[model samples]
Target: MSVSEREKSYEWQVEDARAGQRVDKFVTAQGEWSRSLVQSWIAEKRVTVNARAVKANYRLQRGDRVALRVPPPEHLAVTPEEIPLDIVYEDADIVVVNKPRGMVVHPAPGHHTGTLVHALLAHCGNLSTINGVYRPGIVHRIDKDTSGLLVAAKNDSAHASLASQLSAHTVERSYTAIVHGDMGHERGTVDAPIGRNPNQRQEMAVVRKNGKRAVTHFVVREKFKGYTLVDCRLETGRTHQIRVHMAFIGHPLVGDPKYGPKKNRFSIQGQALHARTLGFTHPRTGEEMTFEAPLPQDMVDILNRLRRESGL
Candidate 1:
């Protein structure tokens, strides 16, 4: 089949560690695609090794390049919902939205509706198809419980530009979080590798083997008797990077159900993390732009309660 305009394309350079893995397995491990879906793509000649069509069981070489194209799902449909969006900025090329806590970024098995994508689809009507139908113009994502600012592209060129900037580590993303313990130091950096937890398949952890490089620079903003407010800037965006790193250092974020203590005192719905500031070069204008969102009311209330208890 001819490549569709809505098909998403991806390319990866096989590293030494993944030299002997089957192409289908490798591709499935990289992203949201399942092994069965990858095999279907391989069978359809949508997957290539070094620009040559490859089989599902092809063993990858260390220096080989693997490319895959995924067409929009014909069986699955993403319906546009009239959910309201907290748009911060908008132009012909892009739109910046401050996604509220408890909103999923894209459509998945259980989150088919009531997602940021659904709201964006209803609001924008026309979004870049670089990420296929489920993700539409989504360039990056923050956790569902972590309310923050994220930008969506209106066209392919803008999507490519923003994605390239993220890969180059030039886009600025800063977060504010409330962690469990008072930090010992005023400032520090967590330069560790992050990958899926071997013990818990559903969770992420700091792993030494086969893990991608992840770094987070953090500074103490305020301290309470049992908790610390911190400003964390990500040098690399890894899934659950901040939560994993903070927990690894004995300071898991407050209300973090996945990484924190089983019994928590806080009554918050989820982790007390928020994407506070986002900066990037305008894809169409080549101008630097930055946007900030104030802490959500729930977080503000928690902080106020802490301050009151400490007589601050």
Candidate 2:
């Protein structure tokens, strides 16, 4: 791999140690840029593997050459709007938020405003930039249709700590979801590799090759004749772990638009999934903490109806 003599161009020849790592991750580790920045660079076609364009999630192999052409930074601005936020916990280092359903974590191509980031910006004025400008303070994310708990880093150190915990799979996350089928097993684990859906560009699918390892452990919390309430614990945070895994196992969530049926008896806006609990070690004090968010009104109301109908 060679660097251009004039501009801010960088290249790397992948080694054994770097093999199997995401290209964006490997490049970011070589420099001080945030993952979001690297991902943006990758998305803008500024990065390439062996002269071929690759997605950010592309896994590198030994002997692969990666090159990055840096253009002068074009500041992508995100305005802070006066959106109401549900602040669950806050301190000097972190902000724990109970995100409502329909609220996005950050700005994306189609979703550029009215996000949790905007609310956080209005509430705190500053957030950790490790995830870059669009995703300040965001340590992790929940789908726009899934409501529940998320933690944001107010500073860089906290962001690093939280990110490390996630990488190590030490952070605990739990979700409550209503699925369409009655699971045969009371508890089970879905260990599969998840990659971008080949058929649908906007979806994820389980693939034997070119997919990241994902594991989800779930327990049947309650059961009805045709539905089940499951508690899911993720071993890896893929884009759509619970939703995809459940659908893969023939038990899609009640109102999932992407992975489930077109119509359901429940007239909910989106998926019947909620991030109910989150646990992690305090970045500052080294103390362990766990937080739980009560089921939202829609979930509560649906459960009530299910109980009444099923006589449970």
- Measured against the true structure, the TM-scores of the candidates, in listed sequence, are 0.82, 0.83
The candidate 2 region of ten consecutive residues with least summed lDDT is 1-10
Poorly placed runs, candidate 2 (over 4 Å): 1-36, 39-76
RMSD of each: 5.4, 4.8
Clashes of 1: 0
Task: State model 1's lDDT.
Answer: 0.90
Q: Compared with the true structure, what per-residue lDDT tens digits does model 1 show for residues 66-113?
A: 998877655326888999999999999999999998999999878878
- The 10 consecutive residues of candidate 1 with the worst lDDT sum are 29-38
- Residue-level lDDT of model 2, residues 76-118, one tens digit each, is 3788889888888999999999999998889998898899998
Candidate 1 structure, TM-score to reference: 0.82
